[model samples]
Target: MASINVDFSVGQGAISSRLYGAGLEHVGASVYGGFWTGPARPGDESRSAPPVHIGWREDVLTLARALRPGILRWPGGPFSQSYRWRDGVGPRGDRPLRFDHYWAKPEPNHVGTDEFLDLCRWIDAEPAITVNTRSARPEEAAAWVEYCNGSMLTSAGALRLANGQPNPWNARLWSVGSNNWDMGAPEAARRHNLFARAMRGVDPGIELTAIGGNPSNQSEWDKVVIGQTAEQFRHLGVWAFDGVASVEGDNPEDLFHAHVASAERILWTISNAAYRLDEMMLNGGAYVGVDGWGIWKQSRQGLQHDYDMSDALIAATVLHGLHRLAPRVGYAAWGNLVNALGLIQATERACWATPVYHIMKMFRDLHGTEATRCTVAGPAVAAPGGNSPVRSSRPPYKGMALIDASASRDVARGRYTLSVVNRSFSDRHDVEIDVKGLPTGIGATSHLLRAESPFAANSAKEPRAIEPFVFPIGQIPREYPFPAHSVTVLIWEETPGLT
Candidate 1:
């Protein structure tokens, strides 16, 4: 049994809905065979134009809607560095299936600016466009921003009108790619400033995301890029793919636990960057954007990570941590939304929700407006040491608490959501959550996500093998049993009194 104390009064800033962002890039089948597969079916209605319908897979679209993604990033990861916006905006047949430098395959410019914006509109998600800082000039990058958010009088806006978007896209988060190693930090910082100037000059109000490299190599990129161009960007975009650089061994269990345990590294990277930005004091309002995050492994399917329950635990834990961090961490986007490192997998036969999709759907659909601090005192489990999952330079830990948790509340304070994860491989936890300032005997219910083993994965044929189920928590201040290797999300209203 465990006693978890949650103080409603103390925590970080209010949670932004953008914290639950999803990335859509042209890596592998992420665009080609994934979100933008097949031809436009009869019922495919474009919400933006209403008259013009385009390429999209219905099954993938349906799953995306259910995921409740708040923000959508596009173009590429490494592909962003190589993509050109101009090639994609004009006509369909006129668009070429150019040989992409990053993925080393032909990228058909099907789901470009227009289709992507329409997607954001259909799914009710804010648009976050990325500018190609490397290979593409500052002017080209600026024109793309103008094409998305400028007035009718602007040249790019006129071009946009000719291209069928009469209304400005008014896209929110504007990113300048995250591949920062080409020119080194100093040169990259300079180039970032140049692109930022041109893009912001076109639309002064547009928010920008600067490259804040992956956690393993962040030290070389973050402080320099952030310090040199703090005024240029609103969020430091960090690509956090936590797992083995390559799947180290045959034992999936070892890699699974290692993946679960290393999830903390995601939060740590954000926290560390946030602290550095705070220390810099140049950009007081800067937020750390989890530009792309998930487990990185050497799967047979290339970067298309076949996510299992282990990845779900990482997703849930990282989300809870991001919630607790609040405004400090901004725009946490899952790497690619369709195939390569995506939440939902798309194939020619059918599309199905990966285990990560269910976890994301649950947390997003039942997201909290406010964050609160919580402490867990529970049974301990030995954390994996050595380098089975991924090599870690940090010293080995004594043990990890079986239960990891975070607290969230509705804006009105009448309702609260507590997400608890049981990291134990075989032991369920009976935990008592002490919610201070909440009343007694209020009604409560819970959502649980679990399976027989963490290694169990979901595919098109067996999507329901691992999923979330809703149950009634009955009352507040009661001992709840959280299943082993599971995520338990509880929601309750407060009546007057203590637990």
Candidate 2:
């Protein structure tokens, strides 16, 4: 039998809701076709913010509201390299059409700055904008910031008013370019400082992020960039991926290992940088932001993924890892939210939730203000396969623990959420969950994320093929059965003064 222990007194760090955020890039059908399925009624003159002229798919909006990603990044991943803020704004008909250099497609610039912010509001998410550090100037970035956040007296803010928005969006989170391209650390720092100084000069309260480069040369890049511009940046931004083209076969077990390996690599990257931040930014807040992260299966359509139950388990593993490394990891956003690597797949008339969507949505309730300690001791399985990364080497984990778990406590409400992952290929494990220093037996239940086959996925036709099964219960059990390759979340009801 597997044994799991959760100690409520042993607090890990506070968890930020942004850690469960998802990003939207202007790649493939993610934006134009998937997110902004145009033609809702024109902008409402009465409302403070509206999707002017352009329309949205009601089905997508309804589903997105339920998913409720805490943060949503806009504009680009690499597409931001060449994206011009000026062209995306103004009248919908007049906005110039630009060729998306990264995706090599024509972008109509319909869902520009204003529309994206409004979309975020509809879905109840905080908006995060990216600046074009490589292709655009510092002044241009400052202007974009001013347009979104500055007072009505400012020129950019005045332009925003003329464009239909009555008040400022006041977007707080901003990140500079990742992957310095041709420029080395020194040059990247200089450019970042220029942008930071200009942007911060406009709004002193805004939080700024600087790129920590890719894994291949991350350490040296961190030294140079952090060494030079430590005072200017609020967080170091990084991206992680574990899927490769070769792993796109029929091996469900291999896919499970590859994704778990990806989770390990992500935590490793955060831990590696946390060490430096501790030494460097001692006086200030220390946190890292994973703005874009997901599996990078080398599909014909760039980073698009046909997500399945296996992918859902991997998503839970990654989220659990983030919970374990709280406060250190400030934020994380799943790569693409709509189409072409999306959690919810959409068509013109209808939309449906994917298996990954169920996991992400279910995991939302598991995270609270504080993280608690949870450890698992059990038999191990040999993880023979490896995943090829976009920048770094394979994961260092040789074998895997049969049971992996993490816990979070809402100190204010006296409620606790615990998650356990059973990574076995075939057999189920009956586990002992020992709770300490907290009262259980108060209203509690378990929700399991599992399917008959790891390869099972949700599509437009069978949207509910693989969904969370909520077990009827009165009190939480000490020993529970965890199915093979599944994630189980157990939540306790709110208790007064439990903290």
Using TM-score as the measure, which candidate wins?
Answer: 2
Go through the candidates in order and give each one's C-alpha lDDT.
0.77, 0.78
TM-score of each: 0.91, 0.92
| Clash count list over all predictions | 1, 1
| 1-499: candidate 2 lDDT, tens digit per residue | 8999998778888888887788888888787766675675445334433232346666677778898897898775788878889998898999998888678899898889999998889888889898999989999999999999988789999999999996999999998775564688899899999999999999998888888866667788888889999988988888766653334464767656655555666666767777778878888585788877776655637565668776776778788888877878888888878877788887654578888888788777555678888988998865544545333345436766778888888867767788888877778999998988576557666788888887678777887888888864656578888899788888775653242
lDDT by residue (1-499, candidate 1, tens digit) is 7889987667556888887888888887787766675465465353221122256766778888777687888875778888888888888879877888667788778778998899888888888888887788999999888888898779999999999888999986888766757678888889889999998888899888888766666776777888798888898887776664323453555445555776776777878878777778553888888778877654544674688887788888899888877878878888878878888886765678888888888787665688887888877755553342333533233566668888877746477778888887777788887777555667777888999987789877886788788867576556778888899888775542222
RMSD to the native, candidate 2? 4.1
Please estimate how well model 1 matches the true structure, expressed as its whole-model Cα lDDT.
0.77
Candidate 1: where are CA atoms >4 Å away?
9-11, 41-53, 244-255, 386-397, 439-441, 493-499
Residue 488, model 1: lDDT of: 82
